[model samples]
Each structure stands twice: as C-alpha cells, then as structure tokens.
Target chain A: MFGGYNRRYKHFSPTLGCSMNFHIYFPPSPPSSPSPKFPVLYWLSGLTCTDENFIVKSGAQRAASKEGIALIAPDTSPRGLNVEGEAESWDFGVGAGFYLNATQEKWKNWRMYDYIVKELPNLLAENFPQLDTARHLYLSVSAFAPIGNPVNCPWGQKAFTNYLGGNKADWEEYDATCLVAKFHDVSATILIDQGEDDKFLHNQLLPDKFSEACKKHGVPVLVRLQPGYDHSFFFIATFIDDHILHHAQALNL
Target chain B: MFGGYNRRYKHFSPTLGCSMNFHIYFPPSPPSSPSPKFPVLYWLSGLTCTDENFIVKSGAQRAASKEGIALIAPDTSPRGLNVEGEAESWDFGVGAGFYLNATQEKWKNWRMYDYIVKELPNLLAENFPQLDTARHLYLSVSAFAPIGNPVNCPWGQKAFTNYLGGNKADWEEYDATCLVAKFHDVSATILIDQGEDDKFLHNQLLPDKFSEACKKHGVPVLVRLQPGYDHSFFFIATFIDDHILHHAQALNL
Candidate 1:
C-alpha cells in the first residue's frame, strides 16, 4: 500500500529576507482522477509553532479524508541563522513569525501576510493539482467553532501582537478581521470558531472585530465561542466532523 | 479577550501493561452552566499519528462549539520504547500502534484497545469536567459524514480497516460495534460520507460492510459517496455544519 502521508518542501523567500518552509498534506487520490481538485484550508499556527505543529498534532486526516479537503500548513515565521535573534526567545525568535511582515529592524525582512496570501497559495496551486486555491478558507476564521475549545495562552497573544506589531493601526492588514473582507470578494461565506476563554487572541478581539468587518462587507460569518475550553488540538479535533460539513455547505459540495 | 484553546495530558494503563498518552478536546460550556455536561466524540488517528493530529488539522472545534460536543484523541500506540521494533519504520514504530495490542512477542505489551476504550475515557471523565461521559457518541462507529468531494485515499482504507478491526472475531473487544452492544445496550445510528475518488481506502468496503453489520444489529447507517474529490480536510470542512446539525438532531441538542 502507498504511504498515507507524504511531504514536499518548497523554498519560499518571505519579505523578512528569510527562506521559509511550507508543508502540504495530500491525501491519496485515484489514478483515474489524476487531476482531482480539492478545496484548500489554509491553516495559520500560533507562535512557537512551525508548519509541522498542525501536521503532527491535529488528528485531522480521518476527517480530511472523509471530507476530501486539502490542508496547507505554513511555517509561522521565516527562519535562518543569519537573522539576529532568530532563535532567541519563543515569542520573538524563529518559531514566532506572527504571520506579518515586521517593520522593525532585525525583523523587517519578514512579510508573512504577503507570503501567506500570495506566495504560499501560488505555490500550492502550481505544485498540487488537488488543491482548489479559488475556494480557500482560513482555518483561523473558522476556529471559533465550539468543538476546539478555545484557550487563553501566552503564545497566541504574542503571535497576534507581533502580527499587529506595536501599532494597533496596522491591525487591519494583519488582523484576520481585515483579511476576511478581502476573502469575501472571492469566497461565499466565512466561518470562525473561537473559545471564550482563549488567552491569546482574546475572544472579543478576534470574533467580535472580525464579525463587524465581515458584516460591513456583507459576508456571512459563522462564529462560535466555545465556553470553558483552552488551547490544544483536543479542542479542535472534537468537532472536526462538523468543520468538514461547514466547508461543504460553503463550497456547495 | 479570552483565548480559545485547551491542552491537557493524561496517563493511562491499559490491559497490555503499557502506559499510554491521550489528548482530549473539551468544548467550552455555557458561562451560566459552568458544570454542564456535553457529548463526547472519540477520534482515532491512523498510523504514525498521535492524539494531537486531529486536534490541530481537522478543524472540528468550530462544529463542536456549535453542537456542544467534546472530542477525544489518543496516541496510536504506547510510548517509552520498550517494544522491540518501537524505533523501526514509520508504519510499525512508535507512532504506528495499529490500534491493536501486539499478540506477537516484543509487541505484546502494546494494548491500544484498552487504552482507547476503558482507560482513556476513565481518565478523560476524571480530568475534563465538560465531557459528558455518560451520554457520548462513539465515533468509531459509522457516524461519519463526507465533507466535500471525496477522493480515493488511505483514509477510506483506514476507516474500513478500523471498522473491520472492530468487528473481526478476535478483535470484537476493541470494536465499537461490539462495545456499543455489550456495554451501552443502545444501538447507534451511523452516518458515513465518502468521495468516489478516494485513493486509499476502497469506498465500497466501508459502506457495504458497515451497512451489513448494522443490519445484523438492527441499526441505521447512512453513507454518502461524493464525487470529483481527493483526500483532504476540505471534504469534511465543507459539510461540517450539516454534520453538526445531524449530531444535534440525534442528541436533541
């Protein structure tokens, strides 16, 4: 039998001037359907996590297989020893890309937004025939589903802050709320699941802000605030079956 | 702004004399109902996977939040490296527990069934207050809904193999079908969704076999085979909202 899991590495040059890695999960497809196109779920991990965090931890393959959705998990930050303090602390160093291009010196080379929205999707559409880039859904937005059980942790806060930088003014571009508006033009619906107790992004900051933005754009946003849960894969896995269904309804599959 | 995530670790001693690791996802409870009990979902990962896989990748939390369900993901095999081939190839090593206890020497100490059924649930109920152990859904049974376009992939194979493992003569103890009848005294309604193009598990094996088994026990099984898709999370994420509705209807939530 063929190996159920396969990995391919791509060399991506982020704005931060550091080469990064992105991993794609390709579920087995039939030979007859050589060029099968699958919906894409772009997953953004928290700080202190690389592309491998979701691949290794979230027991999502079964649901993915059941749903036939392709997963694109990208590195949180660009990495290279040349960058100063790249390996220093968990929040500011290599593992913490904050999904934004930093304007500050030493981290100025990083441009995660462009990388995620541009480079990564471009690469996946080109390399993987199974991925449907036109219908991509941001996992972060749909994370508000109560099944994942949200948490309040330091890693999430630092990552969100870093993505927004010190200036809240830049929050729009770096915030998923802002991104949702841009996605609305291309996609039909937006789904976001969050934990009420999540420590990092803070329940009110993300879903609330994003909901307002999505509302302004006239995009349908499904936001669920799971009560009492914390940050972990367990919280997410509990409702994977439902997540698949949500995407299906949006995609009309 | 609270974070939406939860993380916890549990130690389980199965019948096979080995200690196991399990990770669980507890959906948040309503603030007014701090001690509310919620339904539970037991997620089983494929080879080379641990509990963390589904937690991160499956995107189930959003759905779980909407339906108020808890998720449980457990390691594929026992840890600590005492087994002879624990460090061997990825298919049979530390990550590949095959969801079975090793009857063969050097592997005999691996008891995944006991860990999944008895020990893990016990531990989860004790540690996680949100989970409703008394009224939970046994996911190992058919209750799976295909999310998007289905692909012919290993997931179909794993699902079938898992289903068979649960029904096979000697493995009945590890089987969800048997356990449901033996302990719960309740017949379950199973829902499975598959894409016609899935490359790994032959779609026929599951729907056909499972349907047969359910018929034998006078249970209802719903199987849907989607077309034009490959294995990926997109399949499930697309239809997750509907699945949650199904669960809600089943549980009268």
Candidate 2:
C-alpha cells in the first residue's frame, strides 16, 4: 500500500495578481529511492469550486495513487478579489472561470487560461521536482459537470461579457466546440461522461456540440451517457477509477 | 467489488429539536436477495467539524466498502439555531457539541447525546430495515484527534460551563475519563488514534488522562500514537484503512 500524501500550497501567480490555493497529491512512495516522475491528471472543476472541492470531495486520489499517477486540482478561478460586485454572485467573476484567457480590455489581467495551461504546470514542476518528467508534458482536461457552450449560456454569457467583452471571434477561443474545431495536431482521445438525468442536460451544458466538433476534427472522442446520474461529484466519484485509467492510458503510462 | 454508495439525509430530529444532516454510506452489497445487514462504524468528528467533514475528507468509505461495513457520520453539532452567542465562537456553541447532552437551564433542550446515541439509530433502522440487526445494537465510537477531557480543557471548559452550567457533577457525564470510570457496562472495545505531533496535545486535548481512566476501569482500550501526524483530516486519511479494520474487528464482522 503506497500511502497517499496531500499538500496544500499557496502559489503566487503574476498572471492573475493573486496567491492561488492548489492541492497536489503524491502517492505513497518509498523514502530512500529517488522519487519517480509520474504522469498528472488535471481535474478541472465546474462552477463554485475551489482547489479543495474535487480533492476533498471526490475519492480520486486512491485510484491516482494506485496507478502512480499524480493528481492536481486547481481553483476554478482567481479568488479573494475586492473588484466591484465580485462577492455578490456565485457563478460569475470569481469561481466561474471558463478556462480561457480574457480578451477584453478591463478584465485582460484575469489570465486564468495562462495560469492553468502554462504557469501552474511550471510551478508544479519547479516546486515538486519529483513530478518533473519531460518537455512534452500536457494535461488531459476532464470536468465532471463542465460548462459546454459558455458564450451563450446565462452564467457563461455574463462571465464572458465581463471577462472577454463583446467580440464574438475572440469568444471562440474560450468555447470548447469552437476551440476544438480550429485546433489541429490533437492526439489523445477526449472522454466525456454526461449524465442522462442531469438537470443541466438539453440546454446549459451542450456536450453534443463538443463531441461533434471532436468528431469533425478527427480527434477520437468517447462520450458515455451514464443513466440516472446527476451533476454532483457522486457521479464523478462513481466513475473516478475509470477516468484515472482513461488518463493513464491516454498518457501511455 | 461492492461498489459504494453515499446518501446525505436531513432528518427532523426530535432529540436536537432541529433538522440534522447526517451522511450514511452503504458498502457495495449485492443487488439481489434481501440486503445483508452490515456492521456500522459510528465515526465522531473532533472539535469544529460537521457531518460532512469526515465523510468528504477522510476517504473512509473506500475502506468501509472494502470490508462490507457501513459508516454513519453525524454532524459535529446541530446547526441553524440563534441561541444568543451560538454563532459567535467556533469552539463554544455551533460546531462544538462535545458529544453530550446539555444540562444548563438555557441549553436543557440541547439533547445531542440522545440524537447521536439513540434517535439517529432508530431513524436509520426505521427508514432502512436493511440496517436493522440485533435488538441490543451498540455503537463503537472510534475517534481520531478527539477531545480527551472535555470538562478540563479550555475549549471544553467554555463549552461545559455554558452547556452544563456551573455544576461539576453534570460536567463529569460528558467527560470521557469520568464517564469511562463510572460506566461499568462498556460493550465495545474503545479505539482511539491520537497524533503525536498534534498541536492540541500540549493543551486543550490530553489523551493520557482518558487512557489512564480506561485502564483503571479494566476497559479494553487501544490508543495508537501515530507519529508525525497533525490534527487535520489528511492525517486521518493517512491511517483511515486501519481505523476501518479496527471497527470491523470490534464488531466481529
């Protein structure tokens, strides 16, 4: 039994002008041996999530540790900001980052995409050198109950308008369907597990659009419509073992 | 693979005079046949914790499921009441029940002891007959980082003074050391895991007093001093497997 160990770190990001709270879990490894570099599975949470949400609630670490795969759960968006009306709403501004760089003028400094895609990985590699493996390291993003068409939905619309302004073309980069269709050189298979009984179904979270786009771009997609499951982490926890193996196989670990 | 399932229920408790939220997990029992009754491990959280604390953070469900044992985690204290200074301090009122019935005139109605020991079990049996076992069903209270002498510690001193009033006699009923000495009919072997490096050890929480009292009473007590561990749930998660197995063995499951 490789006993699991979790560390909570405060990372100062120049991109967001904030000290971010991120949790990194290292599987039980021997103390004497040089720590083996492991593949990472980045679990991006949906709305109203801190770095602790998935790390604490979802039992992902067991499968992760067993597979010798490291798991990193980051806060959905930048937090503890006193910017006007930030604390009032639950969805927008703080906890609802759509994982995109803001193109708008006012919220240009809210570079969550840069922090997530670039800076956070660099920080992880720097702080925990045992995780440093190769230059070709890239994350396979998997969200349990993710926002699909962020540019159109009310929650996403407000966040996009506030973060990326009125430019429709600029908004394409943030939307999953738009981004996937445009990008090439994709290798890893994308897996999407949507609950059939979810309240977010039919609208709000359009998983079909993302799947269709992936299909069109020759990017292998595995979309599993799980029956009688809702949008809670219970759904995620139920399928977490499969998800870990999915990533492990994708990374060829 | 007994796939685990967790259900969070808000039961209207007659004992606490409030709707209490408790988390119960049914280990992956088989789908067919009359569902087998599983031995329960009643896990009581430490100071300043809710029912969600251990269930969400401890990762005990995995082990309990593996052992075919059920787990019931009740809230640290009843919530949503405006009892003067109840909302003020973290240690005194809301999150701190000290796992005992209140005797003070003001807090006479605070029957947390009855809720945990009696009412909650009845509700579980009434609602889910699969949990109903022998008539003389007893709970094995295994605590990790628990308050040893509640009546003596500073945090417990404040709680006891308010809940049980100035009566030292009333305070003894709540204190573990005093309760163990007085009560001769201890059915289950008490299992306690104390972190050696806990900050609460130097003050606030003294494990030795309770252990000594249990030894004097000829009660079977297993006190494990886990080295290099803190008071956080991470510490509990590290040793949760052993704790689950400890309860499983005590119940003879």
The 10-residue segment with the lowest total lDDT in model 2 chain B: B132-141
Best by DockQ: 2
lDDT of 2 at B68: 86
Runs of candidate 2 with Cα error greater than 4 angstroms are A1-5, A35-38, A79-89, A139-141, A149-162, A165-167, A182-185, B1-12, B26-29, B34-39, B66-69, B78-81, B133-135, B165-170, B182-189, B215-218
**Which whole-number lDDT from 0 to 100 does residue A217 have in model 2?**
88
lDDT of each: 0.59, 0.77
Put down candidate 1 lDDT per residue, B5-69, tens digits, no spaces: 44547553746565566665556667788788878777676656777655655566667776677
Task: Give the runs in model 1 whose Cα sits over 4 Å from its true position.
Answer: A1-253, B1-5, B12-16, B31-34, B124-131, B135-140, B143-187, B203-207, B212-219, B233-236, B239-244
Per-residue lDDT of A109-194 in model 1, one digit per residue for the tens?
Answer: 66776788888778777776667776643532365332121112344445445544566555445555556567666354555666
TM-score of 2: 0.85
Candidate 2, residue B186: the lDDT equals 78
Query: Which lDDT tens digits does candidate 2 get at residues B72-191?
Result: 889977777678878788887788887789877677657788888789877887787767444455556567777888778898788888988888888888888888888857767777
